[model samples]
Target: MSDPAKEYKQLKEDFVSNLTGGSIGEINLVTAIVPVSVLLWSVLQKRHSFFKPYTVNAFGLDYLINVGTVLLSFTLYSSQPLLLNALLIVPALAFYLTPPDSPTSRKKPDVPPKAKSKHGATATPDALGALPLKPFLTTYRGSMIVATCIAILAVDFRLFPRRFAKVETWGTSLMDLGVGSFVFSAGIVAARPVLKERAAGAPASPLAPRLVRSLRHSLSLLVLGVIRTLSIKGLDYAEHVSEYGVHWNFFFTLGLLPPFVAAFQSALAIVPSYAALAVVLAGLYEAALDKTELGAFVLTAPRTDLLSMNKEGIFSFFGYLAIFLAGQGAGMYMLPRNISPRPGTTKGAQRKTLLLTMAAWSAAWAALYFFATSYDYGLGLSVSRRLANLPYVLWVAAFNTAQILACCIIDTVFFPESYKAVDVSAEEEAHRGATSRLLRSFNRNGLALFLLANLLTGAVNMTVATLDAAPILATGILVGYTFVLCSVAIVLDELDISIKL
Candidate 1:
């Protein structure tokens, strides 16, 4: 008879193997529920005072409505996502239909008094105009984190549908998108420093100093990657070697990205833009995969030496780098060019910026559609998260661009006052509502949350027979796990603690 432990390991391996993923439309819709739910809950708090306590400071109630409900929709209701989506939509529709003269509407808007220098001259637009962008990014990023944390453990159980798991070699799935999205999100945020550096007008710092700074930034991630590798090996944990290869993990991929980008800073400067550079990189990489033997080697080569052993991780780094650069380009468009607006910055200028940003993303989406469908004329490539190929890069870029655009639209529709040019104090007050507290919490301690989730996943897997657990029990375990993560995040936020790296 086979050893039970060995048998269980094989069972787990078979579970995540050979997945082709579901339709993109469905995945997009299911993902859309996260932001929509945030919008709905926010509206409920504003339109109906009764929801304020429950949706705001109360932990249990807030978790159930915001985090828990999303968890359920992604897991239990995953197969029937449309029905779940409609459920969120109905309440939002009702809130919109409510009378305009309601008590909540009667309250005076919190417009801030204009700022004046001691000399009584009008001050330039305060940094507050940038505040509206924060929640949108926070919500987008927080939702991605929550989904990833849940999916990692949930995929081990029968309760979670297989379609949402990472695909074997090709095609799109929720989890596949998560990896790219994480890279893309990091890239978007990293753009700020690049913009700041350019705005400084100083000569580019010496290469050694820049490289040192880049290495310093990557040190924590590299340390985490090492710890994860040693722990997994020491524990003899079940792993899908094909995912990152025999030893390489996602953490290593993330850790190495910064130094690699730094090394290429000069090359990137010569390119018209990061996005253009990304296109060139992805095109060249895809050609290597298609026109040469690289693709065959990655798929079929024997694992031997250090390079061969971690082929997937090494080769895929360039693709992920492209994704990150593309994200930086997107950030340049979305984020303000300077820390402070120019002296004569006007509302019309802000409006123009917003419109151009929307138009740029819309064009990206349109391009994605053309390439994704036109097999004969376009790139005509299947998306391979494994290879991080061109189609996969484009898909990740376009999908995230769409989501960012959606968040912008949601913010504009629900909180139009935020978009208006206002002083920093006034802008902060406008966006300080209870609606996005949880998301803000998640954003504050994202790295901490990710690490905790990884530790918990290992602990749970070792202690529980995840594959053998009944569906209801599996779901209960998942709910409890998610609750713990949420509670920790909330507590950290309350204490004003942000654990970086």
Candidate 2:
């Protein structure tokens, strides 16, 4: 055999080359830097003490650090760890920059003796007790949606490092997690409220209303995706499949499943239902592949119309449903209970509680990950987006949880004003700074940006040769693309012209 040391050296060289050569992980890091920097600066402005005067410098420093972090993350460690840490660090840095007298600035005078409920009555209840959790959840979902769009743009422009783009053999690239977690978070956000309503004996929206609007929305997007492909890339269905990996809104199918799975609400019911369904489908798919005549055909088939629609596309609906249900289960745990308002939790205590919760859950998921990957039942659990297998679901949940935990830490520590419902008024929201505006804009017009990115991707490919771009040039193009998208979306948001499905 060849020298082992030599082989490892070659592999290390290849890894470095791939990372610097526009890897997806690197691109994702790059794309995430701006939004995250904006968020950090927004928090700094909200602090309104030492930071208010240094706002410009803080923004510049945050952006510079973000850019440098991208290099360090991919070079020192992998993207995932660096990203999770970077997200968590933003709030801590904001906290550090917070002036000693900042809280005193916002502190209200002691309540009048006549108005006091008790001698020591307080205006705001503790955030740890029961903070308004919906805003946090909404922010997480919206942020993920925008981030997902950015990641996709980075990938489409041939900015993703070619080394990390090996979807077939790669067990789970950072890119895969980005896509998978986006879908999972989407499912959680979309169904969490509705499912909670059903559980609480609240009347369900009629199935026709529930699915039709969402179905139409997804269909419109699908149509737009297709038209953009045709107009920009030419009318090549086969190539579309090759490029985007099966042309259909996985979200559409996710939207369609909730009505059917409405009866399965509790973990006792939903978890087992998903488990049984996943097991049966996995068995059937495997058996069909191993033993049936159709298996041979599928194995040998090219990207024909039949294969695309049946095996590659629609067949995965079942697996996608499993992933969605898994997200619903996660949502149930993370999201606040849908109940009447009560005394809200204190921001400080809530932050501690959430940090503990996140740590415990991370550990739990890590164990699950170990079991799913190591202890195989003859049927292996692979991370197939098409199959949405057990290991895949667990891994997605694990990492998504960690990422959200990081985000929660950031929100609670730096921007505690947004921790509760009452703090978010139309006037207050309207007057928010550019960073928050950008986030909310992207959140509100998320699907629009997604579609826009698709069109833009096609347009860029048509005009420019993106494949052989240097890393710096590719990053510059990404910055410009993001600026344009954000500017348009921000204006629309300012005008309250959200293009909702």
Candidate 3:
């Protein structure tokens, strides 16, 4: 008789293989959970007295609405995403339409009139009227992390539909989106330090020192990559080698990026914009994949040596780097350089500039995605997460930019006064509700939460025959796993403990 362990391993491998992804519209709707959940929570805070009791002590409610609901959508209701979306939307709309108690309503304080300028407009105040982007960014990123954590282990069970698993070679799925989203999110945040360094006019350092500093910054990721490789090989864990390669993992991909980006910093200066640089890089890589034998080598070459063994990881690095640059461009455009407006710029002008920039960026990315993917009028390339090719990069950029835009719009529409251009004081920040605090916790301890989830996933796989578990049993296990992850994040945040490394 065949060994049960080997059979189980093979079964698991087959379970996630040879699959095509679902529609982009559906994926976008599923992603709506992030912003819509916040909107729903805000409406509840305003309209429901019954919910008021839990407002002060809302950890349970927070978990149920934010974490638990996401878990359900990705598992139990994975097939009926539209129904799931409707359930969330209907309640949020109903509650939002209802009038709030006068005592509970927060009215904006009146501002004293300022002197008029020569243009007959109110003199621009030092502080620009700009909505806070941090909360929206945090929510978007936290939700992505939460979804990744949930899907990592859930994909092992029958309850988690195969449609959501990572595609084999070319296609889209929730899991496929997760990997790119992680890279994109990292790129988005990575922009701040680089821009700040430029703005501060840091003294030019030698390349050797710069390289060393970049490597030092990335040391933890490299170390983790090593540890993960050793553990997987030592434990003989089941792995889909094609996902990265025989020896390579995503941590290595992430670890190597900072140094490569640093090396190219000087070259990048010649390019007018990071977005343009990204397009150039991706275009060149895609041309190489199509015009040369490199594409065949990545897809079908034998694993003869170390280089060939890890070709996918090595080659895909360029595509990921391009994604990173795109994200950096976005960050430079969106994030404020100073707390106040430029000397001569009015609040109205600043707001208009911000909106127009966001819109243009979104439109450009969307157009690129369509052109890259369309066979009739543009490059007829299929998206390949495995290759991290041009189409994949464009799709990720477009999807994320749109999501960011959506979140901003949602915040402006539902909580206008709160997210208004006026600077939010510490007092206003402190008065934020429990749901906001919970979302912030995820952002604060993001890496820690991801690591914990990975460890727990390994443990669960070793302890249980996930493929053999019944649907209800699998779901229960997932619920327990999610609770543990969220609880750890909340506790760490409450204790003001942030694990940077």
Query: Each candidate's lDDT (Cα)?
Result: 0.76, 0.51, 0.75
**lDDT (10s digit) by residue, model 2, range 195-233:** 567556777665567556555546664565455545534
Ranking by TM-score: 1, 3, 2
Report the backbone clash tally of model 3. 2
Candidate 3 Cα outliers beyond 4 Å, as residue runs:
1-19, 46-57, 104-133, 201-206, 337-349, 416-435
Q: Is candidate 2 or candidate 3 better by lDDT?
A: 3
TM-score of model 3 relative to the true fold? 0.86
Best-to-worst order by lDDT is 1, 3, 2
Residue 325 Cα positional deviation in candidate 2, in Å, after optimal superposition:
2.0
Model 2 lDDT, full chain set = 0.51
Q: Report the number of the highest-lDDT candidate.
A: 1
Query: Which digits, one per residue and each the tens of the lDDT, describe model 1 over residues 361-402?
Result: 758745964675466877555778888988888888888888
